[model samples]
Target chain A: MNETALKELLYKIADDQLILGHRNSEWTGFGPLLEEDIAFSSMAQDKVGQSHALYQMLQTLGEKDPDTVAFMRNADQFHNCILVELPNGEYDFSLIRHFLYDTAEAIRFEMLSESSYQPLADISKKIRAELRYHTLHANTWVKQLGSATEESISRLQRSLDSAMPYALGMFEESPFEKDLISSKIFGGEQALKERWIKKIEAVISQTQLRLPDWKALQPVTGGRTGKHSEYLQPLLDEMSEVFKIDPTAEW
Target chain B: MPTREQVYTWLEEVKDPEIPVLSLVDLGVITDVQIINNEVLIEMTPTFVGCPALDFMKQEIHETLNRHGIDRVTIDVTFRKAWNSDLITEKGKAALKKFGLAPPPSRELFTELDVLEHATCPRCNGTNTELRNTFGPTLCRSIHYCNTCREAFEQFKPL
Candidate 1:
């Protein structure tokens, strides 16, 4: 297997979880309902925890420790998709993004569970089980809000339209797409994207939300290659502020 | 040198931090115990990868062994065997019920919401319950409300 390809794959997936987990934590005190608050916070914990596990795997493959890899990096070094780094925006937008992003993630992990990389396969089996709850939560809300009222339907529809491009960016092909697929480290981005589209469409069809034409939408690419938006650096700065204050501080 | 059985017996003193009634041995996180040349090696897995109680549990295991005069303790936490709710021993389930949390049901597959949405009420032992939230105060629990008991309770979620 190509070590570079494997590390690239691991870095992007781990970065996505870490950034989105931080976004989910932002909802802790601000969720529209008590359950939503706990839901996002719980999911945040799971995501961050899952990312740490992935980073540990990377360490075994010769990367830095989880904390250093997560906190010490600049924005340009990150490999998360732009969709996760975007601000939570509003309840409707956050819900929409959650619906979209987790839909893909659930399927991604399911595929990775069968990965030829034994360690990844082992962890993915555990992660895939936990992600079932996340997708369930997201799906329930999306179905409800998508058909609830004119205002809710409109809000979710607008967010869905606006988020489509970035959501598509989630499948931005890594330079090692060929290597990852050939080595069976991953099933490949395009394959995952196809499965993702079908899954999201099935869920959205149950509600009033309309997915944008797949071919018509332009993907906001480059995040996979460490090309992120202006939003990423600030988010990273805030996330790592405490860690930077005392690098050796023990909790 | 302490035998593996003796080490396991000593570890029975260490309880899960969150659920005091249950010991780590009964909780089934302790996957293996090995002793070689006066050194003790213990392998364990977490109920949840992000479970906050994991480190505390590890510390408790070390302290418990240390107290037993087995000072050379090495603990390895891994996903090699990967823990599921089914791993909880029968004794552990009773402990969880006694502790006022519904024990997770034995499950073959967990792809649906049905298993989570329904749980027997620990207070009333009634099946008439409604899921309030799939997530609870902790990662391993889900909140449910029982019509019979008319109380909100947490279930050690089936994963």
Candidate 2:
């Protein structure tokens, strides 16, 4: 197994979870309903914890400690796709993004559960069960809001259309895609993307929401290679705000 | 030498940091305790992967044993095996009820649609209940309202 390929895979996975987890947590006090608030908060905690675990694995592979790596890094050093770094716009947009992003994430973890890397496979197996509930939550809400009222249907449709491009960016392949695939560390982003399309389509088909043409939506790429939206730097600053105050202080 | 039973009893005194009424042992978070070379090694698991209480719980566990004259201790937090509400002891269930939180059902069936739908009201033990929301203030809880007692309560949701 190629060490560089393995590290690249871990960095992107860990970064995606951390950034999106922060976004989900922002909905804590502001959810349209208290239930949604709690649900997003739960997912936020899970993602953050998952990222911490991955970061710990990275530390064993000769990287900086999880705290320093997570808190001290500039936005360009992050490998998360742009889809996760986007602001949570309206309830419709957030829900649509959650549905799109988590659908792919669930499949990605599911594929990695069988990876040849024992540590990655072990963690993925544990994470896969948790992701099951996330996808379930997304699918249920999408079906409910998608078909309910004309206003809700329209709102969700608009968000879905807007999010489609960035969601495609989530599958922007890592430069080591072939090495990851051949090394049996991952199945590569293209395979995961193909499955994500089918899974998202399955859920969307149950509702009034329409799936847009994939060929038409130009993918918002560059997050993998470290070019991020303006939104990311602000998010990183906010997340590390307290940590930067006193890195040595034990909280 | 401290016996395994003695360790278990000591752990029973360590209440869950979130829910003070229930001990960590009663909550089923403490899976095994072993005595090796007079050092206590604890094997424990979190109720949820992202459970924020996990670190505090570990600290409490260490302090509880340490204050009891066991200085050398090691705690291993493992996620290879998941936790379910069925792990909650009978005492823990009663404690939750007395604390105004409905205990989760012990069954393994956890379909997302019906996970929180059937919780009996903790206050009045009412059978007629409606699920207000599947999410609550904490990861282990959900909100439900009782038609019989006309009250809303939290249920320790089945995992």
Candidate 3:
């Protein structure tokens, strides 16, 4: 197994969870409804915790400690897809992003459950089970609001269309795609994207919203290689502010 | 030299911080206990990977064993035996119901939403319950509303 490839894989997955988890936390007080507020907050806790577990796995492979790896990294050092790092625009936009992003993650972890790396497989199984509720929550809302009324439907439709390009960016191939696939560490991004498309389409078909033509949407790539949008650096700075102020601070 | 059974007995003093009535042993997060050359090694798994109660539970385990006068204690939290609701004991299930939270149904036949969507209300033992939210106040719970009691309750979600 290529150690570098494995670390790259772990970093991207962990970074995605951490960044999205932070974005989810931003919804704690701002959800359209109280239930949605609690839902996003709970999911935020779950995502951040899951990322910490992944970072621990990385530490065993000779990476830095979870706290340093999470809090000390700059935007260019992260490997999360742009979809997760983007600002949570509105309730509709956030809902659409949640629906799209978690759909892929649910499938990604499911595939990783069978990973040849025994430890990854073990944690993946646990994470996969927890993600079921996330996808369920996302699908329920997408279906309801996607079909509800003129304003609700249009709001979601517009967000879905705007988010589609970045959502497709989620499958931006890793430089080690071949090694990860050949070594069976991951089933590969293409396969994950295919499964993701089917799952999201199944949910979207039940609603009034339209999924843009897959072939026509150009993916907003480069995040996997540490090239991120202007949005990421600010998020990183804000997230690490307290930690940077006092690196040795304890709760 | 303490027996493995004795160590488990001492562990019974450690309860889940969230659910005071339940012991870690009955909750089934305590996966294995071994006595190795006067040292005690315990392996445990979390109910949910993100469960906030995990660190507190780990601390409680160490404190409880230390109080038992076993100075050499090693507690390893792993996903090796990944916990599922099925790992919980019948005693634990009863304790949860008694604590006013519905116990998760067996996951053996848990493929559909129906199992998760409907829970037997702990208050009235009524099956007429609607799932209010899948994500609850805690990672391990789900919110449900029972028509019989006309009150909302939480369930120890089946994972």
Model 1: CAPRI class: high
DockQ, prediction 2:
0.48
Off by over 4 Å in 2: B124-126
List, residue by residue over A1-251, the lDDT tens digit for candidate 2. Answer: 89889998999999999999999999989999878988998889889989998998899899999999999999999999999999999889999999999999989999999899888887787687678778878988999999999999999999999999999999998888899999899999999999999998898999998999988889999999899999999999999999999999887
Instruction: Give the TM-score, chain B only, in order for the candidates.
Output: 0.96, 0.94, 0.97
Per-residue lDDT of A45-156 in model 3, one digit per residue for the tens?
9999999999999999999999999999999999999999999999999999999999999999999999999999999999998898898889888999899999999999
What interface RMSD do all candidates show, one decimal each? 0.5, 2.1, 0.8
Candidate 1 docks with a DockQ of 0.86
Provide the RMSD of all predictions against the true structure, rounded to 1 decimal.
Answer: 1.0, 2.2, 1.0
Two-way DockQ contest, 2 vs 3, winner = 3
In candidate 3, position A39 carries an lDDT of 95
Candidate closest to the true structure, highest DockQ: 1
lDDT of 1 by residue, A49-140 (tens): 99999999999999999999999999989999999999999999999999899999999999999999999998899999999899999999
True contacts kept of each: 0.74, 0.46, 0.76
